[model samples]
Target: MSKTKSPIELYTKEYYAACTLGGIVACGPTHSSVTPLDLIKCRLQVDPTLYRSNTSGIIQILKKEGLGKLFTGVGATCIGYSLQGAGKYGGYELFKRLYSTHLVKDEATAYKYRTSIYLLSSATAEFFADIMLCPFEAIKVKQQTTMPPWCNNVIEGWKKMYAKEGLNGFYKGITPLWCRQIPYTMCKFTSFERIVEAIYARLPTKKSEMSALQQISVSFVGGYMAGILCAIVSHPADVMVSKINNERKVNESMNVALKRIYSRIGFVGLWNGLPVRILMIGTLTSFQWLIYDSFKAYVGLPTSG
Candidate 1:
């Protein structure tokens, strides 16, 4: 009789698929749920004078655009981040193993240089993930930041953009999206790994010996810390992404658009939404890791470090 293979076996095709599924589950709903906060943040980034504060922004949006408007890009957020998450988490696992196995070859060497592996793996993963995210992101930002909104929904936005500028309209934000997401993901994955490792090192119980709830708690803590770092690292590019998508003139090249926007917003403008992003990303990331690891554990896989 043939022996049964473990479903949770590391680095296998099944394992990568599980990670991708977990990522989709982790990112899509969580990000969509936070669309109100994101909408406010994008508006703040684009026009700093729009609202007195985050709280006021919420009230203003409610008074002006109605409650449902807070979820302006919920569909795009769900779809785009779901696709990005699949590429990110699945690609990270693949690249991390590939790098450790091929580049270092020795287990000890791989462990010694694990941080670099984590950074490189995440950067590479996010590069492609942003490509998946960019078009939806462009739609989301345009609709959120525009005063009257660019379109009623994701489908309308997509049809209008395609009709207007063909593929280029959807893709014009790709460069800035890459700039925002790659560094953000690198900080997210690397810091989460390091924080989880540190937490395990200090704990009386070994990571493997910890209960499922305990392991997930660790994942949340690590994820929150990683998220704060991610916000700070990626805030500038994020602002630029919103600006470029919202204000780019017809026939203006990305380089020219960026330069003109920068000349106007200057250095202070780039950091406009940092605090809200820290809060948003921290909560969002913590839940993401919690959900992701919970899913992995449910499937009999070990929680990520």
Candidate 2:
């Protein structure tokens, strides 16, 4: 008789290391490609009057600064996202395993509880990940927006901010970040798990027995659903983060700036560039899952099913 190996046996140090590295690699290009959308999103969030229409904003940016300006903060964004991706994906797997072992008993119970686990794990991971990201995010937002050229890149931005604002500079937008990320990750990870599970449950055959194509299709749908939720829940905070990250302030307090933005933009203004954001999130989430799963399969790790 053949013996079945435990899930613990499947999780090796090497597997985790690979997952971390793979996540970083997978996130780099995705972040770089989405820089333009990010720029637009930030602009609309910071100054709604100036960028009321997404198409008009894009056109204005293109006309004044040209296409290259759209990628203003690509470098910082790439670094931040790569690190965040590694932490998020690796942490999710590690926490999921821990939860399954300690909190859940039966395999069926594990599956039932997976969505909660995913939400908790991903949110926890993102909290720390965003700390690492806060400085770079500040730099990226400043660079992307209509900030002065003195803040040329992340390093310059960091130096200028520290010189002016001390340690507080790097974390200027952390409150909004928490507001954005907690809900965004909650929706992203939980929705993904729920959607995937629902798809498999509705299938005629067991998901474990499905072909690779079937698994990929399920993952795509799940990812899209998760992305959509994330985009909507986090849009306002995202705009706020961008505004705080940018904007050289001589007089206005952060609260004042926020109030100004709110007064100018209103609720719908927060959702500026949502269409592009949807595309970015949908593509990135789908690809991240596909790549991570493929890597896991290649490394002989057990599939989620």
Candidate 3:
């Protein structure tokens, strides 16, 4: 019988590439599958009174726009988030290693500031991820928020946006996208790492002794906890992202657009979709980490905390 070769060595280009592939698989379909929830969440964020609740939002969309409406932005969501996941997971892994090996260099000191390392790595990863994600996110938001729905689909939306506003059109919301995602990612990685570490500490079994299934389960729990914090921390900026994409005026600067949206909505409006988002993000984050770590284990790599 032939034994499988050991998993790719950590911190190698191959390792990062595998993680990026894993991220694409983890994020794309999962985010696409949640299109209906995202549709409702975006609508609710844009206009808090759009529907009484998530249930009614679905019912109303079906009643008024048909079943297909629930998946208005699935294509954009899939492609955009896949790209984002690649950058986020892969970059986090790469930067974490670089920061530890090059910056800290000392194992004890690195361990001492591990949380900071997690935060910085995640933030740096997300900075680039959001740039790749911005155009698609703009397209997705416009599709969901428009009364008639923006365009037939992502392709049409892209063509139309390009025709109307050129390349800059797609990037109008980059600033808010960064504001929303950077902090969200920072919270996500940091909290998940810390929480998983804590869970392992509390358990009698060390992490290395745990089966793959058990380790991923810990990832799920930690991810869910981290997600709740992520949603709350980032919701306000998320609201602004949707608003900027849907409501920004021609030639309006990001700052001006932000001020305008805030004036219309007020501070309370920023939290409009809080409850639904917490549910969405908590579930989403758990599954993302679950899938990510599961993929890692399948490839013979160690599961992340």
Global Cα lDDT for candidate 3? 0.91
State residue 299's C-alpha deviation in candidate 2, in Å: 3.1
Question: What are the root-mean-square deviations of the candidates from the true structure over C-alphas?
Answer: 2.7, 3.6, 2.0
Candidate 3 residue lDDT tens string, 34-105: 899999999999888899998999999999999998999999999999999999999999999988888886
What TM-score would you give candidate 2 relative to the actual structure?
Answer: 0.84
Candidate order, TM-score descending: 3, 1, 2
Lowest-sum lDDT 10-residue window in model 1: 1-10
Worst 10 residues of 3 by lDDT: 1-10
Model 2 per-residue lDDT tens digits across residues 1-305: 01244333456787677767767866777778878777776666666566755678778888987887878888888888888878877776777778778888888998887777787777887787788777777778777766443466777777887898888877888877878877887788788888888888898987767765667667767877778788877777887787666653655677887787678768777776677677777777777776666655555554443
Scored by lDDT, model 1 comes in at: 0.92
What alpha-carbon RMSD in Å does predicted model 1 have with respect to the real structure?
Answer: 2.7
Q: Candidate 1 on 1-305: residue-level lDDT in tens? A: 11234467888889999999999999998999899999999999988889888899999989988999989899899999999999999889989999999999699999999999999999999999888999999999989988798899989999999999899999898988899999999999999999999999999998867788899999999999999999999999999999989989878998999999999999998999898999999999999999999998888788899
Q: List per-prediction Cα lDDT, in the order shown.
A: 0.92, 0.73, 0.91
